[model samples]
Each structure stands twice: as structure tokens, then as C-alpha cells.
Target: MRVLEMLLVTSCVLVLMVSLFRNTINRKIGTIAGIACGSLLAAQLLFEGYRWQMIPVYIVAALLVALLLFRRSKITKPLRFMILALSIVLLGVSVALSVLLPVFHLPKPSGGFSVGTETFHFIDADREETFTEQKGDKRELVVQVWYPAAASGRSGEKNTVFPKDRGLFHTYMQAYSGYLGLPAPALDYWKYSRANSSIHTDLHPAINPYPMVLLSHGMGVGRILHTSQAEHLASHGYIVFAIDHTYSTVVTAFPDKRVTGFLTEQSQDRLFEDSRAILHVWNEDITFVVDQLEKLHSGAVASKFKGMLDMDNIGMMGHSFGGAAAFEAVYSNPRIKAGVNMDGTLFITENRDAMKKPFMFMKSEEFTNINEKQAKYRKTPATDAELKELRLTREQFDNILANRELELKLMDRLSQQGQGRTIYIEGTGHYNFTDLQLYSPLIGLTGMTRSINGTRGAEIVNRYLLEFFNQHLRGTESKLLAGPTEDYPEVKYPNSVYQGE
Candidate 1:
């Protein structure tokens, strides 16, 4: 919460406590406390801004204080009880809103360079939006690029982290709510949040042809969901491009006021088939975006990236479905030097072979355990009674087993080639790999995600990502990647060739 928000809540509590004992306290003392608390809250609303969620509580408190100041002697016993009860109810509602829809702050990037960001709209003319039945339609992507900016432009400049599109946040929260079955308005507070990067500022002129990294968000998530990670890479001198895969992303707001929401009607029962279909499209999305980047570099497109993109040393990273796309891109596209899969299960069954380039598989503890358990279940098939106890349908159980087996085959191939690293964080879940952890610790608190702190998780992921990209893309040896270090004890290298070396 912001400073004034905290103060307002505290003042509400004080006012409520004073009102509870209004009959016992001296009239003058009660009046002064009521006036002080009410005045503080009024000041917060007048100057600090009003949050609609808490307005009802604020009004109730203000009204109670006003009554206590003006009609202290006229207050009957039953009326005093009603006031106390109402205050308690209002306080509870206020606190609940504050906790659930918190104004979360992203952790500052711990790097040398300040970050600047810009968004570009690209139309993949050759491809059609297969997710929809629209004929002759080109697949569109909104790519947000974050890069190191010149520090000299910082004076008196407000660092606006979020894009100018107001509808984007509403769309994101609405899609997220639909996916999770939560109230859409519960996440509306995110509309006010901002990122750490500045708006389309001049690129840091000292570095030419900056190493580039492409970021892909998980399914039903927008590219901005990984803003913290993107900013971190930008702060450390890597130009990062986070792509919003049109219909696949939670929301994609185009320049022409067109908003594309996630394709939720796709096949959920046929998970693998749906995933594969989506993964294929996303892989094309990545390659197409890279082609656009080439155009930007060649001055074919009006972009600041002209002559600034180091296409030779490009890397790809993604979360969940995006991660699968990253792996597929690395396997199929020669332009991509390396890749990182942040807990994304490989959906492209054909590309199970060892990736020729360096790749890292960062897994969440829950996913790692689930995969291992599923693999074991495949070997030792559970009896009918055991299966019933597990509450998994025969098809569901078989799918889990198959997915586990596929993951093993893929990881085994990568491990054998000596270019892959498989590591999992001790206290993390699939969502920890993305910026959702940073968005709300409530996710972890409510058992919606793992217990790992979002900032710490991002820091760990960023450290490994930086090291991996630096080593492969920049030819800089990262001791952190050579072997497990004591620096991040929570990271475990399971079946990793780099382990024990």
C-alpha cells in the first residue's frame, strides 16, 4: 500500500476503536479524536486520491465521526451498538479490499543501466489467424521492447512503466478472472500500477548492436506479465522484446483501438492437441517477430532499433506455453543462438531430440515432483482402487503418464548432448517463473501459487538467465552456469551435467 493508503486505514481503525467506547470517554476527548481521524481521512481523499473500493468505509467512518462530534449527548445505547457494528463491518470490508487488490510495487532492478521501453505493432502478412475463422486475416502481434536508455535524460522525467493503453489492463484482469473464476473487479486495481522502465527514450548510445532476448508469456497471460524480468534484462544492457501472441495472450491492444482477448473456447479437454496447435502458432509468432526485428535493423521499418539490434547473438525465453515455443524456435530457427524454458512442458512432441544450442530448463518444485511422480506411475501402474483414490479419470491419468514420459525423453536427450541444464527451485510453482508472483504475494498466500517470494524468485531466475545468455550470446563464461554455486542454495541441479563438476 502507498503511504497515504496505510495512514487512511490506520485512521479508520483508530476512529472505529474510539467510537466503540464513545459512551465511556469524555465528550471533549471523543470529539477531538473523532475530528482528528475524520480530518486525516478527508485530507487523504482530497489530496492523496480516492480509491473507490474503500470509499464506502471512508464515508461510514466520516459520518460516524461527524455524529460523535455533533450529537455525542443524543447518542442512545442501541444507536452506539449499531455504530460499532457498522464500523466493524466497514473496517473488515476495507481491509479485505486492501489486502486482495493491493497496489503492488515491482522490485527495482539491481543493475547499472536505467531501462526504457517502447511497443511496436507487427502484422504477419503471410499467416492467418487460425484461432479465428476470419479469412484473409493476418496474425498480429504487439511487441514491447525494453532497452538500456541514456542516463542523461533522467532529469525531471517521470518514469512511466506501463504502456499508454488503458484498456489493456482491464482486458488482462478480465481474462485472468475468467481463467481463475475470480471476480473481474477484484483485479481492477492493477490499472493504476506502473513499471520501472521509462517511455520510448533514447537508447544508450555507447552500446551498438546490443545483444537481444525475446520473451514469451505463458498461455492466457500478456507479455507485460513478465515486465520485471524484461526490465531486469534491459537494465543489464540486453534489449528485450516481450511478444503478445495475439489471440493466445490475455490481451493484445493494437494501435487501431482493436483489443484481442484470449481464445478461451479452444479445446481444453484435448490438452495436448490444443497445446501443440497453439505452440505451433506461437513458434511462428516468434520467428515472424524476429523477421520484423531484422526489418527494423535494416531501416525497412521506422524503429529506434535500426542498426541497434545484434541479430547474430539472439536468445529466446518463455514461460509455460511460451517456453515450449522458445524451445521450438531454438530448434527450428538458426537465428536463435540459445533458449530458456521456465517451467514450460514441451508440447511439440516431434522436437524431442537434443537441441544443438545451449538450453536451460528451469522447473518449479511442484512441476518437477509432479513429473517425477507421473513417470513413476507409468512404470508401476496403479490398481483400479488406487486410481479411484487418486480421483483421476483413466484418460487423465494416461495423459499425465504420457506427458511425463515425453518430458523425460526430451530432458534425457538434452542432458546427453551436454548442452542442457535442468534445475528447479525448492519453494516455487509454475506461476513463480512469471511476474505474477511479483504482482500479488496473495497468490502464494492463498495457496494459488507456491510460497517463494516473487522478488526473490525473479532475482534468481534473472541471475541464471543473464548468466546463460551472457555465456552463449556474448561468449562470456558465467561461473554461475558452469556449476551450482552456494549463492542460490534454493536452486537444485537434478540430473544436471553441470552438477558435481
Candidate 2:
């Protein structure tokens, strides 16, 4: 829950408790103000999600009501009744707003860069082969193919949506608030929901395969997590395939009515090892995909896509654990030309001298900040005015230490090489890299509590990524990436020297 939402709930609880105990006018005022604040907060929670920072406002309001009830006879029974009436109205309105915001227009954040885009799902049986440990399993993989298509023609046939899972995805998505103990999601969860592909596919053909790029999402995240990024690249002529690493994602439901949830990544014994296994599975997946692309380009798939694939040029990319998988794929497969690591901590072991390849790193500012490290104290507010502060046990602290070590070690090798480029987006957290940040504002005080402006941050990061990819993958000479551009002073080119050539 966000700080603000928590505070509001606390305030409401206090008002109710104090009102029941006291017969005074001040206590009544407190009850009214508390109810109003609670209504607003509940609206926020029902609409946006929970945040921690909103508590102060409710606290101040509660205090004011308490003072008025105790000291000001001006706030009579009638005046208190009027305030109570207003509070009730506000509560109703808040509920309505919370419910409408998700389905209706939640204003689009402005100022993001444009890039090529396309998304298509391709089912493959070989996904099972990548899983040696789980061999002979019915390995159905959902491959979201993103590629460069002709600027003026239909790209490929649109894949059919699985009507059954549409509702399920929507339900599970909104249910996140419930799990966090926040108010129920107020909006229609299916508003942004659609088939895996985007609109331009009607005119773009799967033919000109262009350069191939494979994407793997982080743990517990589905393939759609990087939807915007994948589409951007596809529109610009890169065949991008986002692989849903079976059992790595939280849940994957295919058209055939099969659903599988990822084994939790929290288990220590299997965390790193399982992630590595996923990478190898991805490597074989990519290689097989490349083979299929070759056949399709050679007119072998003999369906609607005949002569539209460019199978020769290929690359790989991933986010977080997926980013680490990108490195692992490139390390294992020579066919992968370039790679992009979106602030993922490394899992693969390789020599600093031997592992030389073109790579780019997009890291978050939270990881770089010293004071933002995991806190020792945890707080929770149920209802209002009642705040519970929990002490972090030794185990929690140790877990944090382990995570820090893992992150540091992952970046150490790239830091040593001093060849690749890395950009730490200022004021961004780990979740900021993916589309998860976009969901913050929908959950109320969370947007403010998390300090995520959403608009400027994503724009800056998108520009940086586009500029970097345009320079390296497409061989476009971009001064924006060669060094810091004048417009974006927030981006720093650490560990990379500028060249005059």
C-alpha cells in the first residue's frame, strides 16, 4: 500500500474509535473528518492502489477535527451533521471515480520516443527441448514475434485471441490490489487488454524477417511486460520475438486451455540454477526459431507468409533476469549479433577477457542510490489513525544483503571490461524499466508515494534506449548516444569513452 492511502485508512479508524468512546462535539467532528478522509483514501485505493505518503494529510485533518470538537462550540451538532453529510457524498463520488478511471481514459503520459513495432504469437513444440530437466513435457510456448515489416502493406495474419483467458488475465491483473490488502480494483480490468499483437499488422507482412531480436521477460512477469518496447522495435524493421520462458512467468494461458504458473523464484537452492536453465532453454528456443525463420524465408512454412522473412540478421535482448538470459544466449549462440541488457543483474560466469561483445546497459537510479537501500523498519496502517510499525527480522536483513551481493557481482564484470555502455535512469526504480510503473497511478496514493512521475521518466528512458539501439543495432550514427545529448542531461555515459571518429 502507498503511504497516503495507509494514512487515510488510519485516520478513518481513529475517527470511528474515538467517536464511539466520546460524546463531545470534537469527537463527532473527528468522526466526520475521518470519514471524509477515509472515503477519499478508499477511493484512491479502489482506484489507484495503496501509498504510504498520504497519511500526513489525514493526520492533520483528524487533528483539526479533534481540536474543533474540544475547543470550538461554533461546530455545533447541526454543523457536524452537515459535514457528515458532505463526507458521505464525497465517499460515494470517490468510489465512482475509482471504478471509472481504469476502463475510461487515464491520461496518456506524454513525450516518449517512437520506434518500429509489431507483435505476433507463434506456438512451437521445441520449447520443451530447451527444458532438458523437464523433457517430454508438452511444451507449448507463446512467442510474440516482433519484426520490421514493409512500410505500406499488411504484415502478417492476425492471431486469434483466446477468449477464455482474456477474462482470466484481466481478473488476475486487478487482483494484485487485493493481495496487497488494498481496496478492490474499481476499473474494468479488460480496458487495455487485447491480443498479443498491435494494430499495424494488417499491412505488415512476416516476410522481410529483417534482423531478428528475441526477448525474455523477468521472473513472474509475462511476455507482454515489454509490449511497448517490442512493438517499437518491430515497427522500425527488427524481427523481435519475446519468449515466455515456460515456468519463469507468473502464469501463462494459451488458446488450448492450458495454464501454468511459474515456480516461485524465492527458493534459494533453485533460484540461480533455474534461471540459468531457463537461459539454456531460451538459447535452443532462439536457435530453433532462427531455423524456422530461415525456412519461412525459403518459402518452407507454406502458409500465408511466403517470401517475407529476412532470416539472416539477428540479435537478442531481455530485461532483468531476461537481460541476463540475453547475455547467456549470445554467449552460447554466435548467430546473435548484438545484445541489450535492461538493468538485469548477471547470472552467467564468463572471463572478462574472453566475453567481448557489443552490449548496452539500462540501469535504474534506485540501485545506484546508497540511502535508498532496503530499510530496517516496516510499517502498516489498517483502517485509520492506527499505524503499526514492524521490526525487520535478521532473516530479512540477510536476504537483502544477499540480493545486494548478487546485483553487485552481476555488474562487476561489465564494469571491469570498461568497453560496453551503461545508463542509469535518474529517479527510476527496478520496476520502472518495465511497464509496471505505468500501473502505479491507477492504484491511488501509490503514484505519489513511490515518487514515480511516470510521464518524464519513461520518455527520457525511451529516448535513450531508441538512440542507443539506433546507433549500435541499426548502425545509425547517433551523437545522442555517442555522448550525452544537450536535451537529456539526466543520462550519463559512465564507463564509456567518447570517440571522434
Candidate 3:
């Protein structure tokens, strides 16, 4: 909570306690406490801004202060107790909301430049919507682009970091909570969250043609889920484009006021089959975005990107299912010079050996030796019924095993061809690869994800990510990639071709 918000909650409690003993103590003391709490409430509103969730608390505090100040009316004993009980309930609800929907702070970018962001919508006319068969409808996508911006010391500029659409954010949060079986109210605070990038700002002139990096989020995750990584790369002079894969993402809001939610299946076999099909769609989306970039460079699309994009130099990265898509994208499109998969299981089975460009696989501890029996046996702590509800069937496990074997085989093949590197963090989980780690410490406490410090994990991921892209895409020498330094001790290189600290 912000400072004033904390003070507001504290002062409310203090005023309530003092009101309970109005007759036992001097009436003057209760009056002064109420005045102080009222002052704090005003300060909170002035500083922290007003939220609907705190309206009840505000009303209770105001009534408490008004009643204390105007003590001419002789209050009965039962009335005093009733007022106290009501205040207590209001305060309890306010506290619960504050805890569950914390205003989380994202880690600052370590790079030298400031970041600028913009959003774009594109329709791919060549491809029809396979998920829905509405005749004559084409596939559409919403993308957020973050780029290195001209450095300015002034930080007073109004910026919309996350999606500014309240309805869209609320729908996204509702879908997320529903997917996790959490109460919708548990994520209600997300509407207030913001990002660090300034919107539609001027691009940095230091580098005319910035090397572009494409980012893809995990399945059922929003594009902004990787904002931390995107901002980091942008500050370091890379134009990052993150896509919200329509129908596969948690929620996508288009320009025409239409909102689409993710498509889910209960059958494990159908889920796997659908994943492979969706992987192809995502890969096509990447290629289509790349095509749009080419158009932007050729003055086909009127915008600041004209002649500012180095289409020949590009890299791609994704977390979870998006990671698998990145790998497939590198194989499918020669335009993608390099790719990184952050703890994603490969779903595509055919043409896995075609990848010849630079590639990196950053695995979580749970997935490091996934083909091993012990690794496969280490099931999540959820109950059997819960697992069933989550769709973790035996066939799903078999698919995971098969994907791991294929991943290992591809890594080995790429290494032999001098094009692959694999590394794993010792105490990390699948979600650790994205910005979700920075949102809440309770994520680790839930035993669903491994307990790794969020800031430190981001630093480690950012360091390697920048190094890998720098070495492959920008032709910069990276000592971190050649051989790990003592800087990040948690990263382990399991393959003989790759080195660790």
C-alpha cells in the first residue's frame, strides 16, 4: 500500500477504538482522534486517489467523525455498539481488498535508455479464422510495441503503461481468476495497475534502424505479462513487439469493440491436438506481424516505423506455449535470426530438425531433466480431484514426456550443428520466466511455483536475454554467452557445449 493508504487504514482503526470508550475517557480525546482520522482520510484521497472498493470504509470513517464531533445527541449504548460493529465490518472488507489486489510495483529496467510503447491492430486477410467459422472473417491480432526512446529527465509525462481500457482489464482479470478457480474479487485490483513505458513517445535517434525482438506470452496469458522483459530489452536499444494471440490468449480486445476470450477444452487428447493447431496459428501470427513490419519499412503503412526498422536483424522469445511457438517460428521463418524458449513445452512434432539459426532454451528447475523418471514423478502438490479439474490427465503427462524427448533431441542436433544452448535456473518454476513473479510474493508461498526471489530472477533472465540477443542479432561479443561469469550463480548449463558460472 501507499503511505497515505496505510495511514488511512491505521487512523480509521484508531478512531474506531477511541470511539468505543467515549464516556470512559474525556470526550475531547475522542473528538481529536476523529479529527485526525478525518484529516488522514482526506490526505489518502488527495494522494493515493479514490477506489470504489474503499467507498464503504470512507463512509464509515466520515460517519464516525461526524458523530464524534456532534456529540450533542445523547447516543444509546446499543447504538454505540451497532456503529462500532458496522465500522469493524467495513474496515475488515477494505483490508481484505487491499491485501488481495495489491498495487504491485514492477522492477525498473537496468538499461540506459527510457522506453516508449504503442499499440497496433492488424488483420491478416490471407488467413481465415480457424477457431471460429464465421464466413468471410479473417484472423486479427492486437500487438503492443516497446522501443528505445529519446532520453528525457522529466518523469511527469502522463503515460498509460498497461491497457487503459477498464472494461478490457476487468474482463481479462475475470478470465484469469476463473481459469485458476479463484474468486473474481481476488484480482479486482488489476484495474489500477500500470506499466513503466510511456505511450507513443519519440523513438531514440541514436540508432536509426533498431534491431527488433518479438515477444510471445504463455498460453492463457496476456501480452503485457512479459512487459518487464520487453521494457528491459527496449531500454537496451531493442524494439520489442509483443502479440496477444487471438483466441489463445486470456483475453483480447480488438478495435471494433469486440472482446475474445481463450478457447479451453476438458479432454486431454483434444487439448493436445488443439495446442498443436493453435501453435501453427501463433506461428502464422508471428509471420504476419513480420510481414506488417516489412510493409511499415516500405512506407506502405504510414507511421514512425518507416525506414526505422532493420528487418534483416530480428529475434524472437516466448514463455511456456509461446516459447514453443518461438522455436517453431525460427524454423518456419528465416527472417527470425534467433529464438529463445523460456520453459515452454514443444507441441509440434514434425519438421523439428529444420532449425539452424541461433537458439536458447531457458528451463525452470522442474523441467531441467523432464525426461527422467524422478522429474516426471514430482507431481504438483494439488489433490487428485484438483488435478483432474486442471486437466492434468495421464495423456497429458505422456505428451509432456514426448515433448521433453523431442526438445532434448532438437537441442542435441542444434548443438552438433553449433546453433543451440540450454540453461536452467536452479530454484525457479514455469511462471518465473515472465513478469508474474514481480506481481506478488504470495505466488511462491502458494507452493504452485518455486520460491525464487522475483527481482533477482528478473535480473538473471534479463542479463542472459540481452547477452544472447546482442551476440546473435546485433553481432556484439557476449562473454556471458561464451562462458558464464561468477555474476549469476543460479544459472546452470547442463549441456557440455554450454558453460556455467
Each candidate's number of clashing pairs is 0, 49, 0
Give residue 354's error in model 2 in angstroms. 2.0
Q: Once model 3 is optimally superposed onto the true structure by TM-score, how far is the C-alpha of residue 454 displaced, in angstroms?
A: 2.2
After superposition, the stretches of candidate 3 with alpha carbons farther than 4 Å from their true spots are 10-32, 50-101, 152-162, 264-267, 270-273, 349-351, 374-400, 445-448, 496-501
Score every model by TM-score: 0.88, 0.64, 0.84
Model 3 worst lDDT run, 10 consecutive residues: 373-382
List model 1 lDDT by residue over 59-154, tens digit each: 776786777687635567887788778777877787787766677767788889988887888888888888888889888889999898888854
The runs of at least 3 residues in candidate 1 whose Cα sits more than 4 Å from the true structure, single-residue gaps closed, are: 13-36, 46-48, 52-60, 72-93, 154-168, 264-270, 349-352, 383-400, 445-447, 496-501
Ranking by TM-score: 1, 3, 2
Off by over 4 Å in 2: 1-135, 147-166, 170-187, 190-200, 203-209, 264-266, 303-309, 370-419, 442-452, 496-501
The TM-score of candidate 3 is 0.84
- In the range 254-345, model 3's lDDT, one tens digit per residue, is 87779998774425667667777788888999999999999988899997788889998999999998998999998889899999999887
Model 2 C-alpha lDDT per residue in residues 285-318, reported as the tens digit of each score: 6676666667666787653335655444566777
Q: Of the candidates shown, which would achieve the greatest lDDT relative to the real structure? A: 3
After TM-score superposition, the amount by which residue 318's alpha carbon in candidate 1 deviates from its true location, in angstroms, is 0.6
